[model samples]
Target: TKQLNFLLPDSDATVAFGKRLAPALKQGAVIYLYGDLGAGKTTFSRGVVQGLGHNGNVKSPTYTLVESYQFSEQSVFHFDLYRLADPEELEFMGVRDYFADNNVSLIEWPQRGEGFLPEADLTVSLAYEGEARQLTMTAKNVRGIAILAALKS
Candidate 1:
């Protein structure tokens, strides 16, 4: 497994880090985002969607559950499962369809969807650190390892 850490001094820094990870996702990936409320998960996701060619605003799918952005080569699905009442709800909503091999899926509050979601290729955790945030990325498979490797360079 590969692991990378970053100290983000602010929201912009977190978003910048997301942008750095964007290029490595051209082949698509499943990224699980772990963090408490206000930890910048949505902000980071916004950066990724934008980096992939989204020109409009990227809002959290807290109430809607998921939002999708389309680029020329790939699609990005941003999911916020904080409001999920049961994992089965994911199945009811056809959530599995969102994680296509050719698209990127960024899931926030993934623990809420537990068994219903696919295995993540990468996992990202963010935590509050003084006036900043600490971000950690862990590679769960070969695809993730390649992403981290790309970021290292």
Candidate 2:
């Protein structure tokens, strides 16, 4: 699988990178966001949702757990499992239903749902590199490979 790694100097740059990556997000794609506190995961997601034709706001689902944005042709599900107490809560909430063929899921803190979460097509890890952010993306499946390829260019 192909891997793409780079640096974004600020939140604007991070969002710009996410915007560039948005087009490769096909239906049923599961993207995992890995980052610590204060990282730019939510900012990146906002760029993606906006790029996907959502004219409204994109907020973090930290307290709400999940947030959905509906578009004419597709739906985007942004999940923040940061506060999840147990992974089984995902099953209890019927998370599998969210993975439908026409839906796109961008998951933050996916580690919190570990065993209950579906396999991720792409994994994005963000870390601090001095004053900037270092981003590394790995492809876990064919769809992710295509997405990573898009980032490579």
Candidate 1 lDDT, 25-96, residue by residue in tens? 999999999998999999999889988878899988999999998888888999999999998999999878
| Local lDDT at 43 for model 1 | 92
Instruction: Report the lDDT of model 1 for residue 31.
Output: 96
Judged by whole-model lDDT over C-alpha atoms, candidate 2 comes out at 0.87
The TM-score, computed over Cα atoms with residue i paired to residue i, of candidate 1 is: 0.97
Q: Rate the local accuracy (lDDT) of all candidates.
A: 0.91, 0.87
Model 2 vs. true fold: TM: 0.93
List where candidate 2 sits over 4 angstroms from the true fold: none
Error of 2 at 59 (Å): 0.9
What overall lDDT, based on C-alpha atoms, would model 1 receive against the true structure?
0.91
Off by over 4 Å in 1: none
Query: In angstroms, how far off is 80's CA in candidate 1?
Result: 0.4
